[model samples]
Target: MEYEILGLPAWYYIAMVAKVLVVFVWVLLTVAYATYAERKIIGHMQVRLGPMRTGWHGLLQPIADGLKLFFKEEIIPAEASTFAFLVAPLIALVPAFISFAVIPFGTTITVMGCKIPLQIAAYADKSGGVIDVNVGVLYILALSSLGVYGIVLAGWSSNSKYSLLGGLRASAQMISYELAAGLALITVFMVSGTLSLQQIVADQAGFGWYAWRNPFLFGAFIIFFICSLAEINRTPFDLPEAETELVSGFCTEYSSMKYAMFFMAEYANMITVCAITVTLFLGGWHGPFTDAFPLLSPLYFIAKVYSLIFLCMWIRATYPRYRYDQLMGLGWKFFLPITLVLIVGNGLWISVIGAGNWLGSLFA
Candidate 1:
């Protein structure tokens, strides 16, 4: 039985608040340092010191940058749509953070005679079993797709030709790649037989097959990650904000904290992409020694997430922007067909292996 307080379980409220605080702060800090890390990593790759003056090898740069942006003057284009211009940033930002609510960051933890899941949206049932948001995958997809609206609004509201073009490009890119990303995850859903992200991680245990070992999952992982980069407008797929072309794309007309919000949204989405990749493609929170020392689970999860984040940074440092035609061609002419092939091949493989076998679960 659960203890009730104000018609809700005490654990319920406590868990809810705790989950919000922990996940929010964790994601915020990660986004902050990710900027710093990117600057330093890319700087070093180019044989230069990144930010030596901002406190010991630029350790305080993110904070300093935040402070600078906070204190900076605000500006709205005289010709811009005031209401939409202001609302655009909030729209883009809220989804990036709120989507994490369904992410299973770690397995579980025991404290004060209760087991609390690390995911923000999950709750415990009467029997104390964990209950997660059943539509975690769809929730993420919906929120992610919603964010593109803000981009479009920002561009259109700005009343700038460049911003409008950038916004249009972002929407187009999102449409093209979002399908590939969703199709890739269909394989994951087929294999896991559940939309709950926590259950998907649970299913990947002991196999490590999802990461790279199993051919079908490995294919899905590759497509998913590639599409994720495109979805987030990362370089090699970043035609929307091609600096030389659109003067920073959809954000060209914004300045100060408003722009900072968009900046933060991009990194936050990057973190989100990395987290979901870890949860779906990699065995999340299940690294060695986590079984014995459950506390190690989140650490393992964080490590894997950062590793993927580092890869993103590395790719950004190295890759050139793709041309608009090239981007569309790659998505339609290439990725779409490949995803379909993977799905059909996965079905055939599962049929041959038989669902009773562990390998057959790739499409079950």
Candidate 2:
């Protein structure tokens, strides 16, 4: 069958390009400002001013930081492998940025009488987001896993003992937490009965947000959040880069824009995680009057994501870093068992309630 969109032959590839550019620019801007916000927030928490000298309330801090990094001296360790060392940052950075493509930012809008989705890619059935692949969840999982390669390569290529140790720690930490994170998502898959993120979001529209709708899902959310923090090597779980110990971890030998790439990648991953959390547990882009005002959909999504980002910063400011052993134990001894039990319990609950079939048909 010849596919059609808005009564015309579907030129989805063309539309896809346009959407990608818009989302790319939007994500870049968001990453830049997220850094600024984090510093400002942390400063206030500690009762100190942040970036006041750069612009009013440090409004220009991210730009200034970018410029400084751009102009900084590029340093390659004397013992480092030049090729791998140079490529490591790009490997770390690309996945984080591309993952956002599959994330649904908003609903559809009619532009010049052509119905266009706010998301860059949409499914054949017109669900929003980029590259509406049936296995979007798996795609995200695979891409996220790929980011570790950069860290590992950075450590090995740098020929620094400190970087090597930090990289090893990161690899171990990511593996431990990623299992729990993946398991937590399995519960979501079982409940929603689809791997398509846009479809998952659609299932949670209005009052059906899984975070509160299913008690088990709330537990999954907690597990996912904790595991995500560990996976991203954030505060309390940032063992790989323990400043006092690893001397800046896997990136110890990185300098200039190479260092900046890794930095940007971290923030990008943060935004990606927040976006995914909002899509799966929260209502994606659903909000009050969203049906009437389609533009409000992206706004709602951004608001939810930023709120979660603030929570991340709050935790960063409030908590101390976890001891290496404690971090491992929490992932394996604690979170693993909890998530395994929740998965079984959730599966049984869905079966008992016949939600499995119901959800399948509802979204199908």
Candidate 3:
């Protein structure tokens, strides 16, 4: 069959490349609009207009910002390691882009007598499945952990004391949240009994979402959500990039495209976390009546993910930032122990009786 690339006509590679280009362009555009969406949403919360002068309430704001950054002078400190400084952002941004390749954007469709799956790589393809590996959850955890390295390298290479401090703080923060995040994931693995994201989603098809199954697992999901924010350096846990303290934190020494790379990584990470949340706790691409109409499943999933993203932006605008000490205390003193207890409790409940009976006992 022409399904295999080597057996296909010469135009097959062109078609593959074209598809990639389309997705890449879409992601780039989505990143631009995400900035505008954040500003507009935050502005409403703060009772101030944001970027009105630039193209119809800041619609073109991202374009302007991109152009400005593009034309801006690229600065390198005399004492800094220029190579590492220049390379760090690419290292950060590439993984963010690559991570999306495994994401099942949509299901299979028949076109011109060929069955093509909507994903960039079909799960059946060994190479693409490496991207969509059975160990997807672990891949995400590992990649996200790698994100910290870019910030660290950027800070150390900048040769600035403030940048170095911000990097150190980021390292500590990522480590702390990573524990809660991983533990919360262990709960998911226990419930679904699979390390594969696809299998997890499949397990939720008829049975309702694990998030609503029991209080313990639900609590773990909440803890996971909050810790994910801290891991991504979002507000309330944004100590590393505390502008008043660290002068834009680890990226303080970066300019132009280098600075943009950090923002790209941040937003992309946000999307990834939200998608994973939907996949693990919210039953993934499953929704009411989705099986009856498979084509609509991905849309439902995307909507839910974006809604969560919007909520995060709203919280960022409405709430005051927490003190650094308070941030650490909440993560360590409260969330850590709570999540630990929940995991243990959930395990005992599941083992004593099946998950369904445990749920009935709790509410009955």
Poorly placed runs, candidate 1 (over 4 Å) = 354-364
Least well predicted 10-residue stretch by lDDT in candidate 1: 354-363
Which one wins on TM-score?
1
C-alpha local distance difference test of each model: 0.87, 0.86, 0.78
Which residue pairs clash within candidate 1? none
| lDDT string, candidate 2, 1-364, tens digits | 5577677456555567778998899889988998998899999999998779887877999999999999999999898999999999999999999998778899877665456666665734434333466787898899999999999999899999999999999989998899999999988888788998878888877657777656678899988988999999999898899999999999998999999999999899998998889988888998889889999999999999989989988999899999999999999999999999999888888867744334434555
Ranking by lDDT: 1, 2, 3
Better model by TM-score: candidate 1 vs candidate 3: 1
| Better candidate by TM-score, 2 or 3 | 2
Model 3 alpha-carbon miss at residue 229, Å: 0.4
List TM-score per model, in order.
Answer: 0.95, 0.92, 0.89
Residue pairs with colliding backbones in model 2 are 121-129, 121-130
